[model samples]
Each structure stands twice: as C-alpha cells, then as structure tokens.
Target chain A: MKHYQAWCFDLDGTVYRGETAIPEAVRLIGQLRDSGSRIFFITNNSALTPQMQAEKLMRMGIRAAPEEIMTSSIATAGYLAGQYGRMDVTMIGEEGLREALEEAGHRIVTEGGEAVVVGIDRQISYDKLAAACLAVSAGAPFIATNGDLAFPDERGLVPGNGAFAGLIGSVTGVQPVVIGKPESHMIAEIARKQGLRKDGMILVGDNYETDIKAGLRFGIDTLHVDTGVTRKEALAGHSEQPTYSLRSLSEWEI
Target chain B: MKHYQAWCFDLDGTVYRGETAIPEAVRLIGQLRDSGSRIFFITNNSALTPQMQAEKLMRMGIRAAPEEIMTSSIATAGYLAGQYGRMDVTMIGEEGLREALEEAGHRIVTEGGEAVVVGIDRQISYDKLAAACLAVSAGAPFIATNGDLAFPDERGLVPGNGAFAGLIGSVTGVQPVVIGKPESHMIAEIARKQGLRKDGMILVGDNYETDIKAGLRFGIDTLHVDTGVTRKEALAGHSEQPTYSLRSLSEWEI
Candidate 1:
C-alpha cells in the first residue's frame, strides 16, 4: 500500500479497544512516525481533554502530543470560534468540551449565551437540559460534538451526546450543527489546520459508519479495518464501499 | 345552549394559565357543577398528583374533587396495570407517577423491570436517563406519560417529559407509547370509569392541538374556547374544526 502525507486514525476501535492497544496498529503507527508521516488521532469521545487522550496513548507506548489529537470537542470549538468569534457558550458537557471552548478564547456562561454546545455529560441533569432548550428557543445557536445515539459501555450501549442533543432539538425544534465523524467537519478542520489537500489525506478506522463515512464525505481515501464495531462481512451489503478494507494494520505494507 | 352530563376540561391554558385561573372558565365550571354536571379535569402535567391538582383548582375558586382530576400519570399507570398485571416498573418521574403506580398495585424498581415509564421529572439526571435507556434497550415496554415537548415556565418554555422520552427513544431506537393528550388514552380511561358513552361526553379547552384533537380522536364532541393557546381566528385555518367554538365559557348558557 502507498503511504499518504496525512494519516488520520480513529482512536477507540482501530488503535485501541477500551484500555488495551491493538499491537498491529501500534506497530504501524510507530513505523509511520519513523518514516516522517503526519499522524493525527481523531475521536468522537468528547468526555476527556486532548491532553488526557495524548497521555492515554503515551501509556500504550504511542508518542502523541496533545496537538496531534483532534477530538470532536476541539472541532466543535473551532467551528464556533470561526463562525461566532469567541462568543459566550452555554455548554452541557465535561472537561473536554469545557477546555476546548476555553482554549478557543470563548466564555462559558450559565444562561443567555450566544451558543449552546452539547456533548456527553455523565452528570447531565434536567436543569442543564432545560437551560439548553430555553437558550435554543431564545435564538442561541445550537452545536453538538457528535450525533452518535449510543456507545458501548460496560453494561452495553448507553445513551450518548446525540440523544441529549435530540432531546433539546425535539423541545426547541432547532437542529444543531454536529462537528464529529459521519459529518466531515472534524476532517475538514484538520485539513485546513495542517495546510494539506484532501487527496493527500487518508483515514483509517474500524467503524465504517462514522470514521470511514467521514473520510468519504470529506473527499479522502478511507481504509476500513476489521478490528472493532463494523465487521468486514457487513461491508458487502453497503452500496458505497470504503477505498480499502483490511483485516488488520499488519496486512498493510507501510 | 345544552349542558352535557360529562364535562372534561383541560387544566392548563383552559382553566388556569400558570397559577391564575381564567375567570370566564372558572365561572362556567362553577355553574356546570351547580347544575350537577360530571366534571373531570384532564392535564398533560404528570408532575403533580390528582389531589394536588384538585387543591390547585380549589385555590382558584373552582370546586373540584380529587376523583374529578385525571392526569397523564394516572392514565399511564392504568395502561401498564391493565396490560402487564401489576408488573415491576422502572420509572423516571416524580410523586404523581409514583403514587399512580403504587395505587395500581404495580411495583416500582430501579432496574430489571418489565416496563419503563417516563413522566415529567424535574430532578432528572444522567443516571436516571441511562437506566431508562438500558431498560428500554433490554426489551422492556417503553411508556411515556405525555408527548408535550415543552411547557410554559417562569423563564419561558422548558423541556417536558416528552423531550426526555424522545431522547431515550432516539438512543434506543424505540418509540414510547404516549398516554396523554392527542392519543385518546386518558379520555378513554375517563369514559370507561364514568360508564359514559362517547356521544354523551363533551371536552372543553382552549388548545386545538391537545384538547380538541383528543376529543376528536376519541369520537367525542369538543368545545374550543378562545381564552388561551388556540385563538378564535386560528380555528378558521384548521380543516377539522371543533364541534363547538366559543369566545369563552361565558358564552354558553345552561
């Protein structure tokens, strides 16, 4: 397989499953780094900060700077910053989303903000959801990290940020701007930031619905791996196939 | 104007707006009660108990018995009790829902329930939402008190139980069976309890969407008042008009 200048990898299923790093993916990333290839970690998880993500990768023997991680939270903040110019944001999320907006020089207010940003909040309350609905109804711009309805947890698939966003949307009758995979906002932002062309960028991940779909939507080559969520057998039924499908990173010659 | 044996009135917007009673509605209800008309107050609100609703009506100088009050909570509990035969229920609601379920001899559990009932819960948290989603995904019957997306609050409109139910439904891909206005569930329960036929019942309210629609769907005559929500002018645009449209309850002579 030919190497690309920009290799965007999905963190959760492709590189690591829960706490353990996939050995084949780890070796491939290490080899890509040695060959001076630009590597970026893209994730839909908006609960942890980019630094936390980088630290987790480092523990798995992967060298990653905080800037090398492009979380949905970061992409959302960047989108809002570009459109609204560091406006006051009323957010319902955790440290990751909070830090991303703050890093973008945006103020977080309790009420009457210019925008309402939603992410996965384990501590989510009715009051927070009410406030978001009120703000959105009062003409505040609604922005969501991702549109994933559910995510795999210890107990099975649990409600995600998209579910909460859907609640607020149903209440206020306002659709939010989603800034994660399957939408291509994150990929577009990464390409714009790195001064790279879409043709020179390639996305590698396990999930065809989110990671591969994002790459396809962003006009880039996508490599679907059978390590997680979407099995290789599931791809046959889909009309639009990924650019390449591999069993594991070990199969791909870097 | 002729008076009916059964007078079903919508509490919010029709009888009272927020806390204060609409004087015209109050007087009409008083007159109807003096004439020995069967009065039943119907509300989409599942937060307060029937006794509490009766007390609220009494404060507005509108004489109402606890038996005359029928909330979405009561309908939901009744529906569950009849179908599942006092089965264990996992609920996300307040006192109204709790009391109704208990009164129906249904056991309320935190998890591993046969049904998941959702009502208006002001103290709603992520844990509660997660539990509800988990139960629903696990094949528990999903039932919601109402489908009202938002309700008027001190700070404008706030997200209602339907919004939260919508959130859970979006996550689990399971639509909840709504037991409130526009569904005819509550009205059917009222009809069955009073031993009254649909032809003898008359539903009076200001809202065309919930009040009139409920009556129309239940095969009952509906009286639409222009005191709140649906204005008198707005009724002309609707293809299916109410059985009787009046400026206020004061217009009807018994």
Candidate 2:
C-alpha cells in the first residue's frame, strides 16, 4: 500500500468542465492511476446521474468507474430521503433532482404537488415558478439542491441554484433546506462510506466558497486548482487557507 | 399650480430604519398639503409596510392614506431601478432597491463610502465583514448610519435591518445604495428644498423599507410609523396596500 493511501479529486473544476480538461490535471490523474492510488471524483454539479458522470470522465481521458464518482446531487437525494422517509416531491428542475427523489422512493408530483424540491433548471419557466410557489405555500416542505448564486459558464455567469432558491423563497416567504456539499451530513456519509475520517483526507477542488469552505469543518487538507471557477484574487485573507495551492493537479505526488 | 407632478415618500422602512419618517412615501402630504395626485409610495417590505401604513390622524388613533403603496423590496428591486438612470447602485435596500436610487440620485457607488453624502446601513457587522467586505469586495459606497434591525418590545420576530443587511449580507458580500423614504436627501430636502421634482411633498415616520419605496419619482408619499423589526410578516398577502404607513405624528393628514 502507498504511504499516501487515498486521493479524492473534484471533477468539475479540477478534472473537466463539459469536454475541456485541465492539461496538467489529466497527467496527474493518469499518473495516480498508474501508481495504483485509490481515487474518488467528487463534484458539486448534480445535474447528471453518476453513470453519465462516469462516462463523461472516460471521454475526458480520466477513466472513472461509476462508483468512483460522487456528486452533491446524489448526496442530496440520500439525505432528503433518509431524513423525511420517502416523500411526495414536486420538482421544478432537471433529471438529477427527480432521479434522486425517485431513487429514494419518493413519489414525484406536480400541480397539486405536496413536497418541494428546488434546483437549477436552466429551462425553468414562470409557470414552474408559480407551481413551486403554490406547493410551498400550501405547506409542503421545501428542499434546495445548493445555494450557488451563479454558475460561471464559458459565457460569463448566469443564474444557478441560489437564484432558483431565491425565487421560491420570495414567493413562499421561506428558504429551502439545502442538501449538498459543505453541509455536514453528505460529507460525513462520504467519509463513512470511504472508511475515512474527514481529517487527514485530501480534498482537491476549484471553487473556494463551496469546495474549500465545506472542507473547513472536516479539518481535512485541501488543494485548490486555479484556472477554474475561483480566481487568484479570491485566495486572500482566510482563517483557514488551503494546505496546498497548485496551478493544476499534475503536481500531485505519492 | 406648478410643473411638479409626482409625489414620493419614505420614513421608517424608508429613510432611517426608525429615526425620521420615510421621505419618499409622503405622497398624500403634497396631495393634502401641496395639492397633487398620481401618488406612489414605494417601500421594501411587501409584508405590511404599505397596506397597514397610514397617516397620523390623532394620538392613539390613526387614519387612512391610500391604497397606492409600492414595495420594491418584495419585487426584488430589479423592476423600477432598471427603468430610470444608472442600472447598478450601492443599495441599503429601500423601496425594493431602484426607486430609492432613482428618486434620490441616479448613480450609486459601492466604494465611495462618504461621497454620496449618505446611505442606509443594514446588517452591519464585525471585522472584515462590514466595512472591509464592502470596500474590498463589493466596492460599496459607504456606511449611512446606525440603523436598528429590530424595535423595542413587540416580542415577535425581532430581525432588525442590522441583522439581515448588516450582519449576513455584509458578512457574505457587497454594500448597496439605499434609495428609501427617510434617507435625508429624500425626506428632509423635501422641506428645505422643493420644485426639483414633478411634485412637492413631505413624508415622515418609523419603518425604513416601505416609507422609502415610493420616493418622488412617480409621486411623493411617505411616513414610517414605529412597527418594530417584526413588521415583516405583518402584511404578507395584502392587496390594495397603503399609500402611507405610519406609527405616529399628529401633523400629517389622516
């Protein structure tokens, strides 16, 4: 066994976004694979299913098994279902939200929908907003995927999970229950399932607020890769700074 | 008869959180005092700032203003602000957001702390959270003054302006320009100076968001009555809300 035991890498910003892969990062993953290191890919984007994510990884030249990939969406589903016990969910989002709820045995309904599930729906319309507001106002427990205000795309930043949550909150006059990374339960489960303590574990990612801030609670070591969502200026004045800051993941050793 | 045609008001939820009457929301003042119509009192609190808002009729008893109160805070502050001058503003959150900006001044600064002469301070905080965050991160204009978030007694939900705007948002990011009723420029100047707007008017009182929402752009109307900080949930679903929401003052027409 290697002295450095396990390595967990964040996929979206660390490995790839859409089809683009970080030049230096590709080499690091390949080297790690060749070195026989146990790797788990984590992501905040919960839009797709794990199977799809795994496939995307392979296409990017980073070979990933389905089990190797973990997503905030997946964690969210498990958390909600485990806590509420299979509920009736009303979705104003995409497949990831629906898949998570359904997989948890929660019945999905709309227009007279009982429980509320809010997430990023780029295709969201005013009608969906109306339905969601109505459901939440009618006393359905509201759940949000994440609180990311904007998702920076190739073409500047656009509305993300937080914007959608804001709409629901504005209408129902209530904020939703968030179930993604940075929050404990999901990360705790990730640690437990991987048979590791949050401390001593290495969390590599791109974003600062969500990825890095979430790592703060676990006392885990974090390495931030630039050229992704987080800029160089954002890395200043922190009570908890990333243990290591790398231009890319190709510098990984052990 | 003058070229002035619009009336604006701001007071508690308008200018100062609870010191002076909202200057922008004093529309009925000009109508009853100076003789003008087409009244609009823009406010931030959609909950109850406008509807329950009334002019001071007597000591213990209050009187009616109108059903023309506008709440931009509830409208998300995006609507009216986009209409007039500079799109971006340094907001302290009054009359939604923009109406206050347009009514008081077109351009807003997130960095020039003292240049604008004044602005409201919501949710002020400690360390880099309040002053530094605004100056460093959001480039906010400046700190207006010590605005209270909650009021004395009432025992309900006592969230003061300092809690939401000052604490959370300042801690998170950005400082906004406040265009609400009681901001001295909007309220006091009405008495000192006149003939600048389409209408000449006067507004006063306690709350900040509502009293300031309907500043002089559309028509002058204001008066912020002391409703404590728990006034948010007071007017959640009111239809045909107030043109003037006040807590005291036996001078204005009821």
Q: Candidate 1: where is the Cα deviation over 4 Å?
A: A236-240
TM-score of 2: 0.55
Deviation in Å, model 2, residue B222 alpha carbon? 7.0
RMSD in order of candidates: 1.7, 11.5
Per-residue CA lDDT of candidate 1, range A153-180, in tens? 8987789999989888888889999999
Highest lDDT: which candidate?
1
lDDT of 2 by residue, A7-113 (tens): 67777767886688777877776776677666787766667777888888788777788787767667767776667777777786777766766876878776766
**Candidate 1 positional error at B175, Å:** 0.6
Residues B108-135 of candidate 1: C-alpha lDDT, one tens digit per residue: 9998888999998999888888888889
